[model samples]
Target: SCAVALEAVRDEAGLGRTVAQVRSERERLTAQLRGHGWRVLPSEANFILARSSRSVWLRDALAGLGIAVRDFPGNEHLADALRITCPANETDFARLTHAIDAALAPEAVLLDLDGVLADVSRSYRRAIVETAAAYGVEITAQDIARAKALGNANNDWILTQRLLAQRGIDRPLAEVTERFERIYQGTDDNPGLRMTETLIGDRAALERLRARTRLAIVTGRPRFDAQRFLEEQGIADCFEQVIALEDGPSKPDPAPVRCALERMGVSRAWMVGDTPDDMRSARAAGVVPVGIPAPNDTREEAERTLFASGAARVLRSLDELLEVLPS
Candidate 1:
């Protein structure tokens, strides 16, 4: 898939290559495809879908020979063609050729963001503290830990208000909310406040996975904020689609997961994250849930929680994810 290949290129290049080189390479590839007697279709994308005018039905032909290809339910234009991928290596390209000739179909791959792609908890915690302080109310570390542990649900706001009430600190809810907004907007107040952590092992594993699979970002963080972080990390283009909290309902609810699947045009996918909420969300959406327990979490506790929450598999580190995902 061009999506997958481009992700690899981006990861390797980090958005520093010249536009001319990129364009020239694309043109050269197009010419080569044309030379092969392939009726290359116009693509604003990295890959192309092609069909032979010959009697063979591309999908059926691929299937008859035991190969799989991506097919959308309602797109007529793509209905008869095989979605070919641009493989990153000679071995991969050779495999692709064999699969194409043998007519094998391809499987759709989905990726999870947040804990799977970045560490966002630290940034989120700082935001919570700063937001509370902006309201002229100081919240104890206990409160922050409680809210985060309780799924960070919007209902926490009500609990916060109650806590303030008990403290004899009366403030309008709207005023308090406005202060929270200000803190979120003023991200520079804490230069190090980031929800995502750069785990080198995870980043490398993700880069390897992107070489073949169509990746998506399904996260509980708001879309705008998530995008900002992804762009900052130079990995925004790695994902074909991103489904964030603001895109739909929160986790433990199926809406956001479903939204991610819809955007990625995938039915089956693996949902990976650290929290039980992530597992519950995947279950609600009918997807496989994989848990990557926090390294700092005690092994017994992580195992207990992940198993109790119905994780299909528990990974101790991001590097382990590569073992499960397709190379």
Candidate 2:
């Protein structure tokens, strides 16, 4: 995900701009990791796991500093590494830097790309709008709002039908779908589209975390799209594993998660995401579920819903998860 953000930063925000404007700040952090002499990993999660030099004894060092980084037992490949969640702000970064300086030895890192890297909403919204336009129907903000109210199931088709109906052009469902495909293909790169501010922190956090762990991207997004996004960001080399939707069933189903765990040789692992689906998916896969609330969701509502749905715990932020997990 950070790789996606870095690409977005260069593509949308131009070069050499600090305070990355996009919701995901992958580019900023990627720059930082490269500067720090760490071999950054590709990621799909908001956090990353970096492996320090064997000489450094990173695990013992962090433990000595009173900072606990996530390390799952039973995964030999990941045993010597530390998993770090991306911080949301500059102040958090400062603390993270301090911790890194104290704990790690300069070395290669592993990273996840999900929450820590890309801010997907803006791209997703633009993709939706473009898809709608392909069907010869004009979608308005209200139409989008209505679609959102219905959740992911109704997002594409419902909005397309409503817009077409508003135009007094009732077409067959097949034709509408065909048109949607056409529009989406053409308008996917509209310059006006962008992710929200909440996503900006992802990239920045990844770069910093890279200075510490080995990274991989384990996501429910299809492999084709995920790879394209990473290539665009110029950080594809950072990750060793690029697990995508086709790799297995989508989240809330244990297939993909278990597949990732198997590939990474990770027996004990932490799953982080904004929705209850993330937590549920992790639990279903028998991994630890770390819930990071959506920016728009109420804290109390998130906790109640996630906890009721069987989350091990609900976190206010990614940084909080770092605090709760065993070092």
Candidate 3:
């Protein structure tokens, strides 16, 4: 019976205008979050699930500020999500606003597909190693890493070929390209590539950008594969446009990034990616190049790599974007 009292508060009906006041307060909090560029998911219930790359950090920050918020780190769909009960008072809302403003992103962001936005350690990179072994090339993931470290390289096919050559396995370029494409594209029955990827960026941040400014994808992947990944994550619609391999020459050529910006009709924007090619493309296109190197970047080598590629800013993860975006 004691628990019933707690449950009652969840749906407690009040005087005629009391419900109206609560709804008004909820809208106020939502608007406040939206104002600071947060994606406030629609909530018909008493609580809202706000997605952010810094969910854990935000939750901890709020708690230290004398407020409690529930963070769902267990749910893959909501790993970087926070389920917060609507603020009960203006004071609470004020505190929430302060915490959120501390982290945000640029107005418009063009994101890279594989390494920058998604975790490819077990997906794309793994596929590279597996495909190489399947072709009797026998290369380690480190080989792939070393190849990626070289800036101004975008085509994975080229990277694979270079790695093989370094290992004394020189073969016809066309042959290597064929095998790589076969493994990456996959056979119908085999489902060829694992692509066991996850969003390394904040869904909430992306949503906020979408609601306010332009958010798009400029990737070297074929259009079909990029769409497949986006559709699977239910975020295909998040981006305003997608410029894939089918759109033009891949990164480092500057075509894809230019295509994205042209499609979005924006002259100035931030190009965010995890490779030197991404940095080079942004620079070539005259946009602000923001680089996020491999997730396993050690000794800040990735940072150095991006900087060398003319990246205006280099970050470790998408989670850090909110904190590092230029004002």
Candidate 4:
């Protein structure tokens, strides 16, 4: 075994390359741990000595997530410290960082795009109104809000069709969807209503939150629209995952929320959203459901509906999340 190990080293050049890779990864790991609020000691070795007040909890949490780190339980000198080996490969290094981030933060945040992150009143809601109006049915913002509160109206096209049918004007799903898409995505000669959408909350605050925990989007929007909104807002990099309609069944089904969690390699997370469907989906996925009313939603009605649908907590605004989220 000693002779085989020596042969694997392949002499001074190979050994030097291995040493450089270890040191590079170590530096990156130290910086990541420090960013997660751990007190990482300077090291000249292939591992990091990091201290956290919840070192034992972190150790257990990482272990639950299938990552292991050496921990000192009773030693007076290092009871609150963990010794983590540096991962030489990028994939393992990312897994370690994500595990550490999840352990310290306790839960990553899953966000719904339309109403929670972006104000969709002039885009999606307006599309619904116009699509209904084209069929001679007048739908108000309050009507849209009411439809969303139903919890089964996760997809906007289906919601629009329902609204039209309720008004005694039945339209084919395909026809209603075509009108909705034309209005939302716009024609070649005219920009789509999607251009009217705007982001809610402070971009800086969102970036700050993303620094502490992994962020993901689990939205009913098509994947293209979701990516376009994130890119247009210049906050695309803030999210680690985007689970869109194309990915699976829309919210209230829980499949999309669970899909996001699976993609993130996490089992614990908070889902921030605006509608009852979002709340139900998050809760069904065993995620902590946090609610924020859409700009167009009636506060009392929205809050009542969200709470009734299994929301763990409801916030006045997305920015308020900074105050209540675990540090």
Query: For every model in order, what is the number of clashing pairs?
Result: 16, 45, 0, 1
Off by over 4 Å in 4: 1-105
lDDT of each: 0.57, 0.52, 0.70, 0.83
lDDT of 1 at 106: 25
lDDT per residue (tens digit) for residues 1-327 in model 1: 999778867775644443334444445545654554456676645455665442133443333223355655576765445555454344544444543422222234444555556654454444556656655668765565444344534323444555566567777777655655455454455444553355334455667667756678777666786788778788777778878766877776878778877877766566676667777776566566667755444556666675566566677765665554433
Estimate candidate 3's RMSD in Å: 17.2
Which whole-number lDDT from 0 to 100 does residue 235 have in model 1? 78
Provide the RMSD of all predictions against the true structure, rounded to 1 decimal. Answer: 18.1, 20.5, 17.2, 12.1
Model 4 — which ten-residue stretch has the worst lDDT? 57-66
TM-score of each: 0.56, 0.48, 0.62, 0.68
Off by over 4 Å in 1: 1-112, 133-174, 187-192, 195-202, 295-299
Order the numbered candidates by lDDT, best leading: 4, 3, 1, 2
Q: What C-alpha lDDT, on a 0 to 100 scale, does residue 90 get in candidate 1? A: 49
Two-way lDDT contest, 3 vs 4, winner: 4
127-207 in candidate 3: lDDT tens per residue? 678757866778777667667777545777777777777778887878887887677666777665645677766677677
What's the lDDT for residue 54 in model 1? 25
Q: Return the lDDT, model 2, position 108.
A: 22
Please report the candidate that would top TM-score against the real structure: 4
Best by lDDT: 4
User: In terms of TM-score, which candidate is stronger, 1 or 4?
Assistant: 4
Tens digits of lDDT, candidate 2, 1-327:
999887867774353333342224444444454454555566655566565343133343333333355876687776555566665566656555554542332222222244435554444444556656665656654455444433232224444666567677676767765655444334456433322313425455555444444456666555775687677666676666787766765655766667766777655455665555565665565455555555444567666665554555555554554443323
lDDT of 4 by residue, 1-327 (tens): 999778868787877887888899899988887887889999999998999776765675455345678987679999999999986777887777766665456468999998888998898889999898888889998888877888799899999998888889888999999999999999999999999999898689788888767899999989999999999999999999999999988888989999998998988777889888888887666566778888877788888888777665678876676765566
